[model samples]
Target: MSSQRRSYESGHKPKCLVVVDDTAEWDRAVYYASRWAVRVGGGVVMLRVIEIPDQNQQWLGVADVMRAEAIDIAEQALDRASGRANGVAGITPERVIREGDTIAQIRKAIEADVDITTLVLAASDGPDGPGPIVTAMVRHLGSFPVPVVVVASSLTDDDIDALT
Candidate 1:
């Protein structure tokens, strides 16, 4: 609920919140976040978001099953991402799974964790245009709660290593 960040507090370390959406370039975000954590002595928190469409209440049972399935997929994706972060920087990232609107969930996560000081995202470099999240985020540029770092997907691991 607080707008103020606690990352600089006496006992807290800054953390980067990386969304582990199943994008082709998500690895770039993870790589940057993990490396930054190590270089700055902070931490990495990987988040997987599952979006469910509004449906009839009559399908409550179906919704439960769908939610369960989504959670499983989210876990698998986070596992692979977590492993990649560990492999890249020898650090295991904190994993978070949330369901609902992507931006809303991301905001909630940041609000709940005061130490999360930055959001690391990867931009789509293909002809399809910058990724969905990136497009949606344009609306919140200045009003966003935390600073966002959008890494270009075209950047190779070596390129990111040099930058981070």
Candidate 2:
């Protein structure tokens, strides 16, 4: 076994990888991830990747502006996630932003960095109706180095109100 895995098994803080898409469901996802991280005595790393537009598109000017806006939106979402996690009694989450295909960037970051032990993702609403973000994660799952957890969108307003 790798030294890192050994260390994790010995109770070292496991790195929790969270992929944040700027969506309304993000708050619930953050809350779920924070709860799990606290349970495992792990720290969270939240990532938001800015997906570049395809070259076939003619609106390069608009694409550039959109890209910048997307990055800003992602950063704000991640910041909110981190703040919510920090509000939890035993959880602290570190946030990161990257530019590329979301799954590819996430995989590269996890492989290049040695700390991450488990990946956490929010499940798509359903099959066939799966969105681009969900498709990306599923496509790249085979290449991931650690276990992946898909948090159910089970937390309701009652849960959030309770947390507050």
Candidate 3:
């Protein structure tokens, strides 16, 4: 096993799983996760879930193209989040891409990787309120094996600096 994974599995460190999205709101989660990893001698897993639409597949080629587009978007989100996380000291972030229900994929990721000790999320504070995924996670908190930490959408640079 890799040193980081070993440390994580041995309880020497606690890995943080940060759900990343293609929005500036996710910066808070990334910042906090990176800081926590730096403090705990662990690493961060930046996960991007491509939520496939629940629509009837009438055309196979169109469905394939849509799936490809989703993958590309997910990859871009992961790459951007990775860059942000990498800026923090002592943090080496890994990216994980998944397709399906957001909550289900998150659960699968945690189950697949025993190293994850905590889940981090960035919630929207706008008029729409916290998005559906965040709401769902909140409602199903008891089902999660790892502790969940949510970052408010309104946090400013000073707030982030203080958090780090």
Candidate 4:
């Protein structure tokens, strides 16, 4: 048997990976994903993406204040998500903080983490439409590496409960 086929068959674990942010949309996504994870006997992985700003000038050994601030914001967001996840039963989800473009980071994580079998995200209805990250995934990926579950901003508590 080919190594590729072997890896493909074994790599997928009964786990769900969810992107978490400070927005209400993300909170809804996390709630639904956590419940689903509990019901399916799978674990959840929370990923927080910090988009680093483009620095125009070289900082000759100087500290990058913007990067530091971004990290702080990211940490706070992760803490909020962690607190919410505490109520979830079954498995305690692991949190990951990454620095880069959201889409790129997500793609890298999906490729590197073989345990992830599903990707859960949230989309908000704005003047432009759905959240950019969700839209990007749907547009560029064409066929995502794993099945994606998108929780909308308008989802009610009952809607989230129905996920389980």
Top TM-score prediction, candidate number = 1
Pick the lDDT winner: 1
Instruction: Point out the higher-scoring one by TM-score: 2 or 3.
Output: 3
Runs off by more than 4 Å, candidate 3: 1-12, 54-58
Error of 3 at 5 (Å): 12
Per-residue alpha-carbon lDDT of model 3 for 44-91, expressed as tens digits?
888888876656667767778888999998888888788888876545
Quote the positional error of residue 116 for candidate 3 in Å. 0.3
Candidate 1 residue pairs in clash (backbone atoms < 3 Å): none
Query: How far out, in Å, is residue 34 in model 2?
Result: 0.9
Full ranking by TM-score: 1, 3, 4, 2
TM-score of each: 0.97, 0.72, 0.84, 0.82
Off by over 4 Å in 2: 1-12, 54-68, 124-131, 155-164
Q: Order the candidates by lDDT, highest first — what do you get?
A: 1, 3, 4, 2
| Deviation (Å) of 15 in candidate 1 | 0.3
**Would you give me the overall lDDT of model 3?**
0.79
- The TM-score obtained by model 3 is 0.84
lDDT of each: 0.93, 0.69, 0.79, 0.74
| Count of backbone clashes, every candidate in sequence | 0, 0, 0, 0
Give the range where candidate 3 is weakest over 10 consecutive residues by summed lDDT. Answer: 1-10
Tell me the tens digit of each residue's lDDT in model 1 across 68-161.
9999999999999999999999999999999899999999999989999999999999999889999899898788999999999999999999
